[model samples]
Target: MIRRRTLLGAAALAALATGAFAQDDKTKVGFIYVGPVGDGGWSYEHNQGRLAVEEHFGDKVETVYQESVPEGADAERVMTQMALSGADLIFTTSFGYMDPTMNVAAKFPDVKFEHATGYKTAENVSNYSARFYEGRAVQGLIAGRMTKSNKIGYIASFPIPEVIRGINAAYLAAKKVNPDVEFNVVWAFTWFDPAKEADAAKALIEQGADVVLQHTDSTAPQAAAAEAGNVITFGQASDMGEYAPMPRVSSIIDNWAPYYIDRVQAVMDGTWESKSTWDGIAPGMVEIGEISDAVPADVKAEALALKDAIASGETHPFTGPINKQDGSAWLVEGETADDGTLAGMDFYVEGLSGDIPN
Candidate 1:
């Protein structure tokens, strides 16, 4: 009887140990951010998505992130550390991190990687981005109508296709509504430099641009617009409602939570695969914030109608009759731009002056 009881206790102990190990099998997700999570713009929104993942998974998953990480060698090192530390999946949230992600992914085949705003993929890496140009169209409509000086200022980050597409979309929309509108674009060459962004805004304001738009990730422009007074601005990535009713007339919000959650779930379920995703307003990836009371009621309604049209597929922002910066016809009347053309957009549309910096 003593021998039998001892054997039963040992069996029960083995079962409990197995059960504990199974329960502790948590999925680990990691994120690499280009800017501080408190930037109140792009990185902030991405961090919010990270938080959403935590809320969704509870104890079933563990998430880690390294913010303010620069894009080159530093990014590779950070990713290597994460992979070595047992991260099942990682997200590198910047266009500049594309090559770094690919490099790290090649070394760690079992680790999944997701890169934002880029066009590269591997067996272990996927690319995803929002169609931000769609939202820029709406901002352009408002900027064109609201500008008292008829000179709209554009604070550009890098001259990549994504930023160029935004410039072209905004210019097309503005020129469509206000034929006399002109764009004064300043490429800051940096993504989240508040000082540079502020200087750019002030310079544009000095040059008589009463309306400002930004492709960079910071609220400094809005603040600059506020200090200058009588200038209208729009929020980027996140809804900077703090400056609303005057400088911040409207915004383009990036909703990343749903995508992050879906991808994490895929990794957890062992169904993860490499693919590209480019979502826009139609799928709720891009959102237009409130058109403030500062804008005329008629104009607000018009912008809302345009947003709805874009979301419903009733209108394409890049419809032709558009010309290149050199005055060469690029799009025929009533013709819409193809994804191939848009993805590799490198020239400025006619009516906008200045060359894209290499």
Candidate 2:
């Protein structure tokens, strides 16, 4: 009896030691998402990056995430809870979460924070975004050339620089290829509302738009276009290949795996630092999904060439001889737009109608 009790006590001590080691070995990483992972777009792509971190690190890291988190005070609450729950690193995947992330990071200086599509940063916070406009340029070219009605529709999310840049890039590229191209812009305010997005697409289609591009997340636009039976669409943020060949001719894929893994590794190695990262096609941060055979052979070839040129630094989407919507010259002849201007882009290029909502 005495021997059995001693053995049981020894086993208990061994188990406790093992549990402690396992706990210490794990680096807890948390993610705050603005939409559900199954939204099939922005948040979905971001979640893919989170999954990549888990796969890359395996047992060395533990990850937690909260989906459909609103970007205001709720975001702050979620982030604070994550930090208090022992999160070593937290990624707030939304532009509107910038302030909340900052507020939470200030209280927990030891915890690292990464805010997506936002410009603010702090001692413990960093910002990162993809130059989606590059992909939009390619989509614009396709939309311009393929439209039968000479009207292209853009479903914009917010009136921020990111969405605005996408609009201008697509418009300029489309207008370049098809001089008769006219763009109709619709602001849908919400990023992931399918009902609003679908209604916006329907309204554009009714207005004679045959080619539709979206800066918002969700497959509703694609569904609306597909249901209409003659419209062409491009995927946003994710491949969304389920609707390929017709409506979804191509896509702007956000590849966050490499960045996510690198950052998580930095945390593990004590090399993590607060910095801003903006990367695009050249670095494989933004990828143009496969162009379907539905596009005219010549158009597809030209689009591929343009993509290669952009990737090779031989072409800048916002090249000179461009003007603001008010007819003021924005870029002089042969002058390409600089990063500073692009980062804070607000005005639309000449020939685009309507005012940016305040």
Specify the highest-TM-score model's number: 2
Off by over 4 Å in 1: 1-24
Model 1, span 169-265: residue lDDT tens:
9999999999999999999999999999999999999999999999889899999999999999999999999999889999999999999999999
Question: Which residue runs of candidate 2 sit more than 4 Å off their true CA positions?
Answer: 1-23
In order of appearance, the predictions have TM-scores of: 0.93, 0.93
Cα lDDT tens digits for candidate 2, 151-204:
999999899999999999999999999999999999999999999999999999
True-structure RMSD for candidate 2: 9.2
Instruction: Estimate the TM-score for candidate 2.
Output: 0.93
How well does candidate 2 score on lDDT at residue 258? 96
- In Å, residue 265's CA in model 2 sits off its true spot by 0.5
> Clashing residue pairs, candidate 1?
none
